[model samples]
Target: MDQETAKKLLVEGGTFVFLGVPQETQFGIDMQCWNTDEDFRGIKMIPPGLHYIHYSAVSKGTGDIAPRSGIMHYFQKKEFLVKMWDKDKDDMSREEVSEESIQRLKDNLYNLDRHLGPYPYEIWLKWKLLTSQITAELAAKLSPESGIIRASVELLSTSDKDRPRGVKSPEGSMDQESADDINTENSNEAGQSTAKRAKRATAQEREDAMLPDLKPAPGTALRFTEIPRDKYPPGSTPEEITKHYLDQSYTLELMIEQQEEPLHIIGELQFSYLCFLIGHSLDAFEHWKELVILLCSCDDAIHKYRSLFFHFIRTIEIQIEEMPEDFLADIVMNKNLVYKKLREFFRTAYMSKVDGRLLTMIERFKENLTEKLQWDFTGLDADEEDERPVVVRLDDDAE
Candidate 1:
């Protein structure tokens, strides 16, 4: 931003005052992080917009900390908001402070003025784009009623406890095994002592699984009640399978079949993104992962769900674009796992007989992802004619 614009934003921006947090607690808004001490009590001159505020409580003598928590809020110009941290609970208490207390705090604002710091204007635009569509109402709707997300949280599960990350309910590890380990067996010698049987879901896994995912239950997954497919008798042909697919509903059917409105879907997507990338909530991230995979795997539904896919692409595009510099660094340190999985789905649909509009949108989505992340997917798509089989002459084989 230019100096004039920066100054203007500074003059017009809002503020968030978080009080009572201890001096050494880790706290941040958007992608910025700072240790709270007596010198600073609030963020000032913040661009008036929707932002995800997250924080963690540091432990003494050890790095271990409680699960991180995040909340999305929309700030308006010149707005002032305050929260009183609960030391006992290790969070900002949800109960409202009495009006007398509010007035006392307001009166002391002048005394505390020097502790507030200006917003990092340099990152305003990036943050704006990331949260443009996330509104306070939407956040409220998707968040847990009590306004917290914890490690023990799960989504829409009937179980009594919050499921931990990476463990399926009542099952062993869901981590995928390597291809090289396909046929490997337990390393027990002939008639030698056998190793103890693999344990079932650990106590930790059991606890995590019972934690309900705080998101609105419906948005956890797409709702496609029914999709017709041909069930041919014993000896079905390729033609039969093709016909079965054709018999399914037309474009956007899967999305339209949603029990909830499209707005709910979008809100859920935004919520999941916030949880994973910002809140660092593993369960939310898992849901986000599953949703992305489910959408990408919609090769059979792509044509029948064209509009849905179109909106889905835009939803994911914005989420990717909104990723913070720090978060993106962590996400891609190994590999862009989310992007790679999405690319697989896109490539699969592209290789299939997908709707033209959906295909074009998919390409555009990939282009945006590449541009935003500086990623290279150059070799993913290939010329069909180059890879397809060609008719050969008998004489050519002789040569």
Candidate 2:
């Protein structure tokens, strides 16, 4: 679909909820039912293309949704659903939104608190009340088995202003556990459906909170000072420069290469090193894979830094896993990237730039697998062990 269609679908099809907060922090967490292009309410279909649900909250003006509280949630279309359904073909199809099928979703959403975790009061109240009414009205618009598409409703919590407008709190007979299955036939509907917009924050507050704080963490050798690329050959693209650095056709040994400016080379090296460093801290395997791809982009084999870089990476990974919990926190918060320790080691080995030694190399990349399996097998035993002393080896207590 075109961008305009995509943007329209986002606002129309997606469910918006707000996480009420006083600050103008525009952050959201979206969850998409990727099995079907349809959403939880089966109200709209999402268009394809790297589809993702945008769960963001817009800040309230001084007196819109709340005096200073912003919108709890922002809505966006679930583009990921198209990809997910493509991958998981056996999953429910959009055509299968019969009464039987919708009942399952209803059961799931109603029991969401039980299935996942407790939801906020506003979400619990709004979804329960609105969906119940919508479900009952199904017979009027469509068959009970026929899928009824309702305009996606924004689920929200009752603000202090909304509370006094004859909104009745759920009666004492309504058990929190049983509240999920509230019968729509007996419920009252909310009136005056409207979207409330939040006010803008002052320029200073916006600048302070919106931009990423890229300061160097304490104890790290690196310092951030944004240097413009005016010094480097201005026309060279980042990708081209990186490729040139790693090109086997080029050799650092060639004396002619020494006359070239250093900024491009330094920039490429720092970029690769940053990727390698971040790979150590990333929890997801996919993220590490992406980092590996980034590292490969800096592959200038003529410089002959392979062995040192590989071993440096190995050491960082091992040391991060080996660090005590307290020390790990310090490394994470202060030393910055866990692999940054390798930078100093790299500097020390700069003279022997072609050194084949790995400073913290593991015998094999077996530690990660073994550690993962140990936790998987230990299950709840792992939680109990948090209070116990950590052993140097998994078999430390074994004969």
lDDT, candidate 1, 286-377, per-residue tens: 67765665566445566655666677777788787666677667666645556565656666666775767777887888787678777656
* C-alpha lDDT values of all predictions: 0.64, 0.30
Question: How close to the true structure is residue 73 of candidate 2, measured as C-alpha lDDT?
Answer: 18
Badly placed stretches (over 4 Å) of model 2 are 1-233, 237-297, 301-303, 324-363, 366-399
Best by lDDT: 1
lDDT of 2 at 164: 42
State every prediction's TM-score relative to the real structure: 0.61, 0.19
**Residue 302 shift from truth in candidate 1, angstroms:** 5.8
